[model samples]
Target: MSRRRPRASFAIGTVKVRAGHAREVGLPITRLVTGADVSLPVHVVHGRDDGPTVWINAAIHGDEVIGVEVIRRVLTKVSPKTIRGTLLAVPIVNVLGFMNGDRYLPDRRDLNRSFPGSARGSLAGRIANLLMTEVVAKCEVGIDMHTGSDRRSNLPQIRCDVDDPHTLDLARAFGAPVIFHAKLRDGSLRYAARERGARVLLFEGGEAWRFDEWAIEAGVRGVLRVLAHLGMIEPVEDEPPPLSLICRRSGWVRARRTGILQMEANLGQVVTDDERLGGLSDSFGRRLRLVRANRAGVVIGRTEAPLVNRGDALIHIAEIEQENETPGQAELAEPSE
Candidate 1:
């Protein structure tokens, strides 16, 4: 018979978190202009029993704040004594951008695209390297939280490689409304982590800089359910998770005219091809054009901005396959990672 490996304290940086306990540790990032140090704060929960280690992170985009709250609430519910494995919670990864309410770092680089970075690289790259070396490298699974950029909003959804059987099972356990089979982008954290042999789930919902209550609630529930599925914690007593809508293809509908957009399509609402989604009009109230769906799918994301330029994405629709439907060839929508 195979023997179980001996358990030990979880060592992160210089802090050794003892088993059956939790601690908040800080990993130094840089020194501000005023000489004050900025560090990435992490909450480490080392469970009593042995199991797979998982890391949950938020604010990768800085402005996507909903996951911050989700992590906080999840921490409140999980005790090191009860959990079966280690849980690493990072509430804010882009501390510089988060402090300034900016999506990109002070160097104007998207942190999400600077993964597996060199220690001597740019600010974004260095931060990415710190996370990869100190946090991601220690985990078997990672949950990356995000939201729609700028004025866009997303329905609660899980973006991942659903073709992988283990990953697909975890996505379903997450209980999001939609499970999107998204391809990994180059230099993205998901791509980098996968390269290191870790399963990753990217959660997208709400919008930047605001707390959408529904999205926050769903996010909390989904994280807990994933923990349960991993056998790290006991199952939560929420409603049975949805028979998630599996989506393989998605496309964006753009505005044909530069004008004020009045949208009728709601997030998570299903629309048929050629259905009138809303209309566009000029400043004088003259109708310029009408926005319509090009395919039948669920409305997964949409622009909340009233003013839009020509060719700006107005609505995002995902072609879905139900649990009982036969899988078919389809393409996913192109959007920022």
Candidate 2:
């Protein structure tokens, strides 16, 4: 005789998902000018066994599509009948911005910067509040997926509070190329979730508005590893990723002059202090200046835009440290928001 107790239905808004089943719940947002209703689509996978609930969200900045793919692939591997915990997969967060291929909302507010918001606030704030109340508040862990924005590309890396023992362990299981010890920003989703007692891992990879196969693979593998670590699923079949490097501090190297750029330093390459990273030239083929690193570190991000203005960030470097050594002071500049 089966000894399983009667499973309760998981409710989100008005939608209830029976235990060991999955449901797509559309939480009403608002109505369009054309009288069409806009809703936040949430994929709730309520597992058979009891365990921790986790959320994986992507496309907070609509142009960052890599995370959307990562969530989709992850959902395919996890089944409601076999898993131990609930997985709230929100594949798209900025639906309005996503529809228009933009990064911000219609009112030009960054959705990421509006968090733990009020119900009667602006559109971005309301949306953030909705997500916080409907999904993140119920979870113990969250993974907010992202990529380099404003025409920049990033190496696959995990950003979290490396000082926290538990979060650090989760980051290690994520198996990104690097684990950046990042501090929380004022209005970020990670910050809001942290305030609500939820641990978060921010995954950065690829460039905006395009799909990167390597980044997608890393994200899929990392999410699976995290799930396994949490005992929500069985062990992953693939070989584990290589050991991740730890970053104590990171900063961006800015352009010296306004011109067309040709980057010489590739992503993931180690460079010495003040080493040449790229060159700049005028439209008339006259050499302008050579861009150099600000410190000894690994190249984690680079600009994809050819034409840049003076003081524009051309490359991002993370000062790496061994796991045994103590983490250094805060970053010269935060690499990501």
Candidate 3:
């Protein structure tokens, strides 16, 4: 019979982040600087354990930085002594955009749009290739954190192709009150990973270039809970998780007429097609162009900026049937992680 390989272990300063020492460990992925063998800023935190090797990566779009911060806090408090398998936390995947405070690479290409990446292509494509090979290829489970575009904010939510059995369990274990289960897009990180037989989850919240404490806390705690479900972490006694609503359908509410927008509802609130979500006005607020939802559902996400144009995406909403029921609302407990 074949034997399993031994697990590797390590420590980080005062924190004991082990891969199998006890449970999981977080490792720092040292990066090499551009045009030199020297390294740039990049890191990972690995937990020690015999469980699954799960990777949580964030900041694919430099301006969408909440995940970077969220991963940082998760590392500070994750006790390597408690992890059962492995946890790899990568906070900044897009170094160039992160450093320059731009959403796209210097080539002006959306990094997230390039997946499985090009081994020989533009800077963004190259980076994507490196991650697919070195980081994601090694992981059994992955979570890519994100936020809405610079113009919008997203409520705390978990999105995945939940039709998959394993993914459905994860979306539930995440415990967010809102869930969007759908298909994968071409060339997305989720698509590439699934092709490799790894199930991944995408956590969306807040807006690009801005931070939401509530959303961050929700994300950190949700990830920990998922670890528990995967046998990678100890199960701690906790309050009942928020009841989740599955929105099998979601779409953008475009601007019918170009004008400045003033939103009436915040992210997470429910909306209908007949009701006014927000309205548009001339630069002087004289003539108004109203915006409305195309279907009935929750306002899981929306734009943050006031500027708008006809057909410009204003809100990214998630919905079920017009009469589909949802759980009663109870304020989510404060994030403990």
Model 1, residue pairs in steric clash: 249-331
Q: Estimate each model's TM-score.
A: 0.93, 0.93, 0.84
Compose the digit string of candidate 3's lDDT tens values, residues 53-74. Answer: 7889898888988898888887
Between candidates 1 and 2, name the one with more favorable lDDT. 1
Task: Please state the error at residue 252 of candidate 1 in Å.
Answer: 0.9
Best-fitting candidate, scored by lDDT:
1
Q: Which stretches of candidate 1 lie over 4 Å from their true place?
A: 1-6, 323-337
The lDDT values for all models are 0.90, 0.88, 0.73
lDDT of model 1, residue 34:
100
Off by over 4 Å in 3: 1-6, 9-48, 321-337
Error of model 3, residue 284, in angstroms: 3.9
What would the per-residue lDDT of candidate 1 be over residues 49-132, giving only the tens digit for each residue?
998899999998889999999999999999999999999999999999999999999888999999988899999988999999
Q: Model 3: what TM-score?
A: 0.84
